[model samples]
Target: MKEYIERVTDGEDLSLSEARTASSLVFEAATEAQIGALLSALRAKGETEAEIAGFAQGMRDAARTIDPDRRPLVDTCGTGGDGHDTINVSTTSAFVVAGAGVPVAKHGNYSVSSSS
Candidate 1:
């Protein structure tokens, strides 16, 4: 965690593997301060595609599996950090899709940068 914080603070992008490991650490071991610093640094430096993918994979790995009765499912989620005060479009879209008889699996952490 400290290594990730230091590396990101130095504006050096982590390799996909590094990002993955760091993300795993975030869920399993990193302190709130460490997570905050890492996220801030990544935001300041702008996350790369590999970093995003690796982090997403790490989160997916840590998530609990849900069986949907073998039915098709869709999720309406955003990358967040939209920096907007507007309504959450993804959340609204999920309801709309569900109302239209489609299965929706909307999920995300609370926004840290926006009102949504």
Candidate 2:
């Protein structure tokens, strides 16, 4: 993890596996300061698509998911948060999907102001 941190601090991107490890560490039962350092360091180095995907994959794996045997298994997921330009397309799409007799499982979150 420290090596990954060093790579990122040196403006080098982490490999997919390293990113995955770093992502897991963020959610570990550790101190907030430790988490903050990880986040802050990553933020300072700017984000990479591979890193972001690895992080999201880690978080998704940790999340509670529905059983695969559930009926009406339709997904209309969204990334959420359109800043001040949200047009509710995702919400509208959910309604449309449900109206078509498909069980729409929409997942999203409130808009957050992330630092650049």
Candidate 3:
């Protein structure tokens, strides 16, 4: 799971400051036993949209980035699904938005599991 997290954040070029902030969050959120249980529960039951959205908001609040003067910005994200049979419509949507003159920040991951 740590490896998965590292891969997901690879492009962020996380600084020592960022690492410290994440470490603080982890320390504050769970004891060792609770952390283990949380991971197990998520793996078993899958994460809810609210949980994922909350995490995204938390990361945005914690990290530093260009403000773009409060201009409209859009992010396109996909919740990976099972099976290789599905084509990436979400990935295509990002390009379509960019082609339509909207600024988009797209995020994606390589399929690592058969269920992804």
Candidate 4:
């Protein structure tokens, strides 16, 4: 949909030419029907560990331009899907560590199902 494309591309700081290239790539790769089917299948099956690992590796590669040496950094992330009803213990731990003068990068999604 046009609205979906607009929302995805708006204010992304990309050049016009770059945006056009990306749009072309998306359009050429998958039709709306194909996209819908792929999404449905992925949602039903869930992502495999290899798929997740590839995604994470891609993210790390994309961050190569960033200088990690600028700060003494540490990341605190928890595996396992906590239902978000546990009072955000990990977030609290991040704050405590930060308060104790350790730089922490905490990554978490909002809730398992939005209302949880």
Judged by lDDT relative to the true structure, which candidate is superior, 1 or 3? 1
Give the per-residue lDDT digits (tens) of candidate 4, residues 59-93: 44444253357586667765325655455566678
Give the better candidate number (2 or 4) by TM-score. 2
Following a full C-alpha superposition, what root-mean-square deviation does model 1 have from the true structure?
Answer: 5.9
Give all candidates' CA lDDT scores: 0.86, 0.73, 0.55, 0.51
Candidates in descending lDDT order: 1, 2, 3, 4
- Distance (Å) between predicted and true CA of 75, model 2? 10
**Cα lDDT of model 3 by residue, 14-87, tens digit:** 33444344334655664675546544544455555544555565566665564556557678777455556566
On a 0 to 100 scale, what is the lDDT of residue 47 in model 2?
Answer: 85
RMSD value for candidate 3: 11.8
Off by over 4 Å in 4: 1-72, 113-116
Where does model 3 exceed 4 Å of error?
1-70, 112-116
- Top model by TM-score, which number? 1
Total backbone clashes of candidate 3, pairs 3 or more residues apart or in separate chains? 0
Over 4 Å off, model 2: 71-107, 110-116
Candidate No. with top lDDT? 1
Cα displacement (Å) at residue 70, model 4: 6.7
TM-score of each: 0.61, 0.55, 0.35, 0.36
